[model samples]
Target: MLDVKAQSIANLRAQIKAIEEDSGAHGRSEARSSQCNGNASRAQRPHRRYGTAIDAQRNPASLPCGCSVLANSENDKQRFSQAKQTEEERDQANSAFAKIQRLLCIREHASALLYKRLLASGYEEHIASEAVQRAIDCGLVSDERYADVLVRSRLSQGKGLRGIAFELEQADIDPHNVPAYQEARFRDSGPDELARALSLLAAKPPKAKRVREAAYRKLVQKGYETDVAARAARIFAEQHDSVAIETR
Candidate 1:
């Protein structure tokens, strides 16, 4: 009985040792599986430091601290600002052109005059100049034509060539074109200067006691050259004396 009891006690000790070994082995296997699952989860998770996947694709030079996102936003803002400024400039140019058209419709203007008008009406310098150039290109404005018309008008009003030339210069007519217009109108198709001067003197003779001097002064004031004025005065005085003698 004592031997059996000792054998049973030894058997129970062996079974307990076997059970403890199996539990330890199962725990080690479960620990390894848990470690593998954790590694996989970490590998599948996205990195938050680089922003979204799309953002990373767009900016390959992205920094770890996310500075690339700010740079991209700034670049987008700059592009938008440039586009807005371009649109505003285009609108201003169109408005300037419309103003020029209205001014031309009312009456003729020299290119310089038109530009000045636009400035006086508060248009920007570049806008005014562009509008004026457009008008000139489209044949709406012409310095040559303006000069010619002014010369004709002044002549009809009994203004001398020198006076008309000065007026043309003031009106911004080109210096080269001024002489051309003068030669065309006076030398080619207009009345002789001397005849015009004499005719003026005859119509309105001097009433002063010194007739020749007075007539010369009057003709000079009317824009004739001194030489032409003197000759016209002398002829008029002689004609007056002869007429007086005939009446007596």
Candidate 2:
């Protein structure tokens, strides 16, 4: 059994030695053939070169295509970045514009009211200001126009001059434009102030004792002048009492 084991060891060594020798001979043969193969490859492909740094002094053409590819890639990257930036800017501007347009469509607004609304809606001050300015430049947002509309509308609802004034002030209107706004929006065509006050009293009686004093207080609360409201209420009560006495 010992001799058998020694023989088996000898056989394994011989096999390993044969493998090494065969590998060495094959490597030598491949080395001798590689020179001819290298020359043939170069002859067939003179323009092509290899390696990470093919633009070496002796291999200029090796990376001409690579250099051009890199340049084109860089230019494309820059152009794409610029396009993205421009699109974002345009989108922001459009968003601001849409918000302003929506508000205007709902109703006319004074410049101050519009600006405050924009700011309250989370718009930046500069953007809101720009939007308001452009609207004004386009004649879309005007304090005077807003005042005129408001005054006329309120007058129809039985609001007196002082009532309209208070409303305009609260809406941040220009006080200087009030007189012009009143003249323009409410012409002298309708019933006089006194007549309107009488009509209001007829429609919605005051909570007072149906006397001039009660009417005067109600008119004052509705934004009438002290003297004008007192006179209107006095005249209205006198005429009403006369009619009642005559009917009785």
Candidate 3:
């Protein structure tokens, strides 16, 4: 029985040893399997592509919108400023033009008054003469031509010498020239003036005394002396008397 017990113990020990060895082998296989699974997972893992990495790292906020809104805003502001400046310049130009027009009107009126005042004040004749000449040059009046025309028209209208002289003085005509003009106007009259005067007299209604009075007054009023008026009226009456005799 003792010999059988020892053999059983030895057999049991061997079985236990075999069981321990199997357990150790199984643990080592399990470790190798875990390592293989780790290796396989590492191999299967996706690689980081350069484009994807760049895209992930890129900031949308950093990207340019590529629109001209800012530039356009600046350009619009510049245009608006230029337009504002141009409008201001135009307004200033209009204001200047209005001022020039007003000044011109004042100058013209002042020039007209200057001659009258100069004559009345008994200013130096040359100064008054120059003022009139300047006014003529500036297109205000033409003294020489106007004087000639005025004298002729007045005498033709039968204005008296006194009335004509008075009017000439009022118009700022040269006092020196008025006498010459009055004399020359009558002196220059001739056979042509006689014919015209007779014709004008003939047109009058024959009231005899009234006609003579009107003819005398008209000639006298025309810057003619009393002698000239009487002579003209006599000459006109004689021609009419001759013509009446011829008609009978």
Best by TM-score: 2
Question: lDDT for each of the candidates?
Answer: 0.76, 0.75, 0.58
* Clashes by residue pair, model 2: none
The alpha-carbon deviation from the true structure for residue 227 of candidate 3, after best TM-score superposition, in angstroms, is 0.5
- Pairs that clash in candidate 3: 158-221, 158-222, 159-221, 159-222, 159-223, 160-221, 160-222, 160-223, 161-223
Model 1 ranges with Cα > 4 A deviation: 1-72, 175-190, 198-248
Q: What is the TM-score ranking, best to worst?
A: 2, 1, 3
lDDT of 2 by residue, 36-65 (tens): 898898765555544333333334334444
Decide which is better by TM-score, 1 or 3.
1
Worst 10 residues of 1 by lDDT: 59-68
Q: Across residues 59-136, which tens digit of lDDT does each residue of candidate 3 receive?
A: 322323332342245444565578788896565444433433454455333333455555565554455556555555
Clashes of each: 0, 0, 9
TM-score of every candidate: 0.53, 0.53, 0.36
